[model samples]
Target: MAGVYDPSVQQLRSLLTLAEELHFGRAAARLYLTQPALSLQISTLERRLGVRLFTRTSRRVEVTPVGRALLPLVRNIVGATDELRDAALSSLAEGGGLRLRVGLTDCATALGATRRVIAGLTTRHPALEIDFRVVDLVEQVTGLATGRIDAAFVYLPVAEDFHIQPLTTEARVACLSSTDPLSQRASVCLADLADRPMVSLTPQVPRAVRDFWSVDPRPDGVPVRYTAHEVSRVESLLSAVSFDGARAFLPAVAAELYPRPDVRYLPVTDLPPCTFAIAWPEADGDAPHLALLADVCRALRDEGLPTDPPAPSPRTDPDASVASLAERQ
Candidate 1:
């Protein structure tokens, strides 16, 4: 490779860190370098690569399309290098067992799929040690990209760099305050909530993912009204609905996992169902451990023991009531 084309591992590491943080100062702090030093490194890398990695303004920083495209490749390179180093050290240690860290969103945990998956993995790989980390929905993609977690059970429509295996598909449901008039309905249509203020995820969540969850632009093409308060966790989101009178749309599994007297989950008759899947770095798809886990998931699905609960049936009339959406579905 030419001299200019040969960027050091540290340079690549800095680029990956900056891409994750999207803030020069914070990325500098994480890398233990001054902001100026980090900027110089990024600029040098871009000059050598002949591509602008990021677009920076006074208030915000955004990665360009090229930067997004390169991010996973850089991450895989760094991850493989680190794994090689770890492997060398593990070889010198006694009775070193392989460990895989799996990430889960709240919905995954609530549905008991993570537990079943872990159990199956343990049975298949007796010596493997599995660790489960609860990650917020918005950060699951970032977690996978940066190798913070080996694989994650997350909602669909992830970036192109991920390999997603469909797990379970469930109906979409709305979370509204019990006192809200819509809550009285057996099932609500997207148009019914058109005028109500909905709770939305923070901007950290990708636009497409957020829009999908928010059920934006009711089938009629007008955007659903959303409150200013953006939540990052399911607990906070439900609390907002219970007390703040804000509505939210989530998977039917959420209704099963979290049953609150103050909130009602009503099926959306028109919106498409949400699909949750196992997402991992596409570069690492062929690794034995990841492959085994994926196999376990597929086996469970084939056996008809999905991690998610069954989707509840929609109510035919507002006056025809049921105990809860979970029971109906």
Candidate 2:
């Protein structure tokens, strides 16, 4: 009440990004601003607050005591601003358009199925704007629960509270080292993988989901062997399979989608097929739009339509332009 403090929303966002990244270049890249511009924003904000927020050195950036104390408050302000903007946009409908946030789980190999549904929705509702995010195993349902994503194409074993419809099921394949003896065979069973320990998934993943992916407590009732280290992403899992004498279960499509010279995907003969499902919050079960989305998903799969290709991967260059990314995707 004693101080006059007003900082632009972009400045506050820059503060949050810099705090999270702790590096000028990366934070600037994320903000789509030059380093000097970001530094100016931070400095101006600090001037108004009458406190230094960060201690900067050539090699590193450290948050000051005040910065740490202010982070939660800054987060709240930013979150509220975002919520208000979203509400206003919803009311306006941006030219009578509907914006949906769709999530693609890292474990969703049936991406083709999800895309077909998107296409169907687009054909029917030309004004629908689809904003989809690719989330990892850790953030699978977190995105949905937090409202970051309106719906999700996720692997099975999602919480029972959500309305889920199985879209497509594909046989699981064992991702193993190309040099492993079992890789020589056309296919292998769970028993054949006894010596090959499973890669432990991230601790944050739900127990039931992990069990579903790992096929825990083998069909023969044998204890499944898992590696001591845990992996949270596909790249890490691929590295583990390549060098750590570990194996992971992925949908058979991985053989083509993720091709690595040192890794081989052998069909797992004994394990049951893994399924992908389209899930949404239970509250939306009666919503006409969501019902239509689910129907499109089911029809695409049941009708055996040609699979939809995934958007191409964008360039890794930090300076890549938005137009370039759009073209690639």
Alpha carbon lDDT of residue 295, candidate 2? Answer: 46
Candidate 2 lDDT at 6 equals 77
Give the Å error, residue 216, model 1.
2.0
What is the C-alpha local distance difference test score of candidate 1? Answer: 0.75
Model 1 ranges with Cα > 4 A deviation? 1-96, 298-311, 314-329
Q: TM-score of model 1 relative to the true fold?
A: 0.64
Per-residue lDDT of model 2, residues 1-329, tens digit only: 74457787778888898998899987775554689998999999999878999999889999999899999999999878867754543444445556677888555533556656787767645556778788887776888778777788877888888887665555667788877776666667898887778899888788898888888878778888888777777878888988987989877666556677788776566777766677888987655446556545543533444322222232232222112111111
* Each prediction's whole-model lDDT (CA): 0.75, 0.71
In the range 1-329, model 1's lDDT, one tens digit per residue, is 45758777678888887888899987775564689999999998898889999999999888999999999998898778757644543442224466778888877775455566678777655666788888997678888889889899887778888887765566778888888988877787788888778897888888888888887756789877778877888898999999989999887768767778888888777878877677889999877567666656654643445434455666754433233433121
In model 2, which runs have C-alpha deviations exceeding 4 angstroms?
1-96, 106-110, 286-292, 295-329
Model 2 lowest lDDT segment of ten = 320-329
TM-score between model 2 and native: 0.60
